[model samples]
Target: MTEEPRLSAQDMIDRLSPVLSLRTRIRAVAALLAGVTGAVFMGTLWWTEPGPLPGRTHLAFALLTVFCLAWAAYGGWLLTRRIPLFATDQVIAAWIGLVASLATTAVVTVVAVQRGAGVGLPSAAGGVFVAVALALVVRAQARRAALLRRKHELTGREER
Candidate 1:
């Protein structure tokens, strides 16, 4: 019997429909906007400081600005890319986001505690961030699993 041809990535994507849902696209736009806005605000504050800041403060500002720009770049890349391999990409991005959120929360909580400030507000905000990041992680994993299942089914059909 003649063997059937395997589907290429593009062929599989064409059959699978839209690469990203509207929600995901909206998230990308939001990330891009938030990152840009944060970077601009931080840069302006740093640039307009009337007095000389400590070296540590300067380093902190620079690091924050770079972090914002990195998120902006990631969002822009996500928006522009049309490849079908983003199921894995989304999973990776989601995990990175979760880790970042956790780290930021820990830092904020520690700083607030050390400064003799009430930890209530910081803890609440951190909880929210962690929750959202966790939700995204879950959604990304589920989406990736669904895609893999569909890919397997399609490949099996092609073999038949």
Candidate 2:
């Protein structure tokens, strides 16, 4: 069996992003679409709330806004770059998905508890799917970064 040629860290990083596999391309597209949707929703929520903003509410609004903004920004960046957009960026995007999921679930749970209503299964499933897909992308990128770093350290030569 023949081993595949090693790729340099820079090369690997470059290769990690841009023009991905079809499945990954789908994930990236989904991330962007969800990011935009979440950001818009959160932005409107933050803007339209009535009454004075209290400390905790303000903080919550800030964090949620930042997270969702990051989600959208990362997605746009990825699309503009047309590359894999790196692992750290992917990690950020994944958190966006997970947060979107958790936040939606939490809201539904809180409302259901208050109103004695049932849960929304479809949204929960969609969120979970987005989270898992982006997460897989993050894991793959982190793994690739680590492997490239280790190989570079051992070989003392960065192969392209």
Candidate 3:
């Protein structure tokens, strides 16, 4: 009797987790980075200013920041939680998110200090970003380690 051929690690990974196309991955990463950066920059600059700003300026800043955050959230969802990205891609995305989150927090804190508004709206928003990004980073690392372990096990079995 002939034995059926076993699936390789790559094949198993394909079956277990469908891969996203390169273009999609790139777009997702870009959107996430740009959105986060824009939001942080706009929010920090707009919210920290002490003088009474015009209503239009407030509206513009608020609209722009919200739009950026929405895009960032969408891209983040695709790369980190919803879609099944490659282990390397996942790791990269997670790290990018962490860096962005750290930057956001830092900017917010600095602005708050400058404005003498300790732990205000900006701080709260930044805290949320850091917390979520930290969770995503931990999750991504765990998933990558798991994939590597599985690959090793499969390779060992194939050898046997």
Candidate 4:
């Protein structure tokens, strides 16, 4: 018997269909907008303030921004490969990004408080909001994927 082929990353992206269609483009756009807005807010706080931002705090914010951009960029890249793959990968990346942001925010908040920097509160809040938004976006994409799969199943049954 012939062995089943193992899928490479690019092959997987090529095989899966996107869960979100043109109707759901708004979700991707929202994710991008939220990511950019959070990045701008955190960047401003980190770079323009009078007192130096604590090293940990600066790094956390920077990582948060990078993850956001990565999520967006990955989603865009996946879209050209396969739509379903794009949705699946986007959800996975968003979840990882959220967790990383939350962990970083927690570490930075504790460090900033220890250093007597009260300004870290705003930063912490911003990080939390970004994490929450990312999580929500992932949930939305998952739901959309499920709906699409169901529709495809129904259509296939009718065709058969």
Which candidate number has the best TM-score? 1
Model 3, position 4: C-alpha lDDT score? 97
Model 2, range 30-133, lDDT digits (tens) per residue? Answer: 76777678778878997899989866566566667766666667766666656433355556655665666666556556555556665676456656776786
lDDT of each: 0.79, 0.66, 0.74, 0.65
Tell me the lDDT of model 1 at 137: 95
Q: Write the per-residue lDDT of candidate 4 for residues 1-160, one digit (tens) a residue.
A: 9999898998887567555667556655665566667677777776787877667767677787776676566545544543344246556656666666666666667776777887568576867767686867678687767766776787763210
Candidate maximizing lDDT:
1
State the TM-score for model 3. Answer: 0.50
RMSD to truth, every model: 5.7, 8.3, 9.1, 9.9
Which pairs clash in the backbone of model 4? 17-83, 17-84, 18-83, 18-84
TM per candidate comes to 0.64, 0.49, 0.50, 0.47
In model 1, residue pairs whose N, Cα or C atoms come closer than 3 Å (at least 3 residues apart or on different chains), thus clashing, are none
**Tens digit per residue, CA lDDT, model 3, 49-158:** 89999665576677678767866876776666444444655666677777767766766677568668986788789888889888988998888878777866777532
Cα RMSD, model 4 = 9.9
How well does candidate 2 match the true structure, expressed as C-alpha RMSD? 8.3
User: In candidate 4, how many clashes are counted?
Assistant: 4
Which residue pairs come into collision in candidate 3?
Answer: none
